[model samples]
Each structure stands twice: as structure tokens, then as C-alpha cells.
Target: MGFFQLLMKKKELIPLVMFMTVAASGASSFAVYSLWKSDVIIDRKGNPEPWENVDPTVPQKLITINQQWKPIEELQQVRRATR
Candidate 1:
């Protein structure tokens, strides 16, 4: 049988194949995004320059702390008071 017919006969493999394809595509996309977001400075010759020569104008991505959660100490105090 041809490749397509063989694959059709094995219906159980379809979901696994689809999941792997999607997972691979997502990974590739994320890899490209990370590379694009990197701070490497390319020279006129299309090669990356040293880290010291990179432009300082680009803003770095900052990690934000979640302010929604109350402090554990305060929570403990409140719980003790309520009891």
C-alpha cells in the first residue's frame, strides 16, 4: 500500500502525529521569537558584535512582581485575629 493508505489503516497514530506536529511547530515559533528578541547587535558584515558594543537604547524586558497577593505574615495575622 502507498504511504497515505498505510497511515489511514493505522488510525490510532493520527492523534499522536497531529499532536507532535503542533508541538514541533509551536517550539519552532518560540525559538524564532526568542532569537529575534535577543539583544545581539549585528555588524554591517551581518555578524554579531561583542556584547560591549550593543546599543543601550533598547529597553530590557523586566519581570513584574504580582501585587495582588497579600504578604504571608499579614495573612497569618488576619487569620489569627479572625479565629
Candidate 2:
């Protein structure tokens, strides 16, 4: 019999299959989160650079970009009028 057919005959395996799917998804998500939170940086020479060595101007540039992209007040007024 085909693998799917076997699964159809054994209904008890449904819960086990669901549990394994959830477990695998949770493990993968945790791995992605851990990588995102990691501050370790690799240099061009295959050396790890300390977080303190990162450029200080990067944060300042980000702040300037955010300030430049502020939302237009006209759009908010239009939305309020429509409501």
C-alpha cells in the first residue's frame, strides 16, 4: 500500500504527525530568533569582531533617516475628514 494509504488506515498516527510538525516548526523559529539576537560579527580575515568595535555613526545615520521619513500631516487630516 502507498504511504498515504497506510496513514489513512492508522488514524492514531495523526496526533503524532501533528506534534512532530509543531515541534520542528518551534525549533526552527527558535534558531532564527537566536541568530537575529546574536551580536557577533565576522571580519574579512575570518576573524570575529567585538560588538564594541562597530561604527558609532551607523546609529546616527539610522536616526537621521527615520527623521527624514516622518509621515505627512496632510494625510492624517484627510483620513480624519473621511471618517
Candidate 3:
């Protein structure tokens, strides 16, 4: 069941739960994007320099989850079937 439906059943905690959910969603998404964003160093002319390298530990893909592979593989299969 969806969160809104769940909250509707509860009635009293609806506002509280919704507010918390919205705040949590915004905060987490923004915080995660900021943390993983490319930290390129710009020069005085507003050009990014090659010297500004991301740490080796930083991931190329923003998302940490490995579950995305399943869908990607499924898509490839679908594409082949359509040919």
C-alpha cells in the first residue's frame, strides 16, 4: 500500500507523517546528490582544469545499488527480441 493510503487509515498522524516524509525525501535526495557530484576545480577563466580529479574511491555511477543491472539486462533481452 502507498504511504498516503496508510496515513489516511491512521487519520490523526496523517499530517505529521506526510510532513516528515516530504522533508526526509527532499533532504536525503539533495544531500546525496551534493555529496556525490563531480567536484571539478574551475580556473580564473571559468574553465575546469584536468588537475581537479575526483578521488579514486569515488564511484563512477552515482547510485550505490547494484540492483540496476537486472533491469538493464532485461532491456537488452527485449531489444534483441524486437529485432
* TM-score to true structure, per model: 0.48, 0.48, 0.35
TM-score of candidate 2 against the unseen true structure: 0.48
Residue pairs in clash, model 3? none
Between candidates 1 and 3, the TM-score winner: 1
Cα lDDT tens digits, model 3, 1-83, are 98778777889997787799899999999887765456633353774544345454556565776533223678769868988
How far is 39's C-alpha from truth in model 1 (Å)? 2.8
User: Which pairs clash inside model 2?
Assistant: none
**C-alpha RMSD between model 1 and the true structure:** 15.5
- By summed lDDT, the worst window of 10 consecutive residues in model 2 runs over 54-63
| RMSD to true structure for each model, in Å | 15.5, 15.8, 15.0
Candidate 1, 1-83: lDDT as tens digits: 98678779998888888899999999999777666544644353665545434444554444435434334788669868988
User: What is candidate 2's lDDT per residue for 1-83, written digit by digit as tens?
Assistant: 98678779998988898899999999999777655432634353664545535544345331355443444699869968988
lDDT of model 1, residue 6? 71
* Total colliding residue pairs, candidate 1: 0
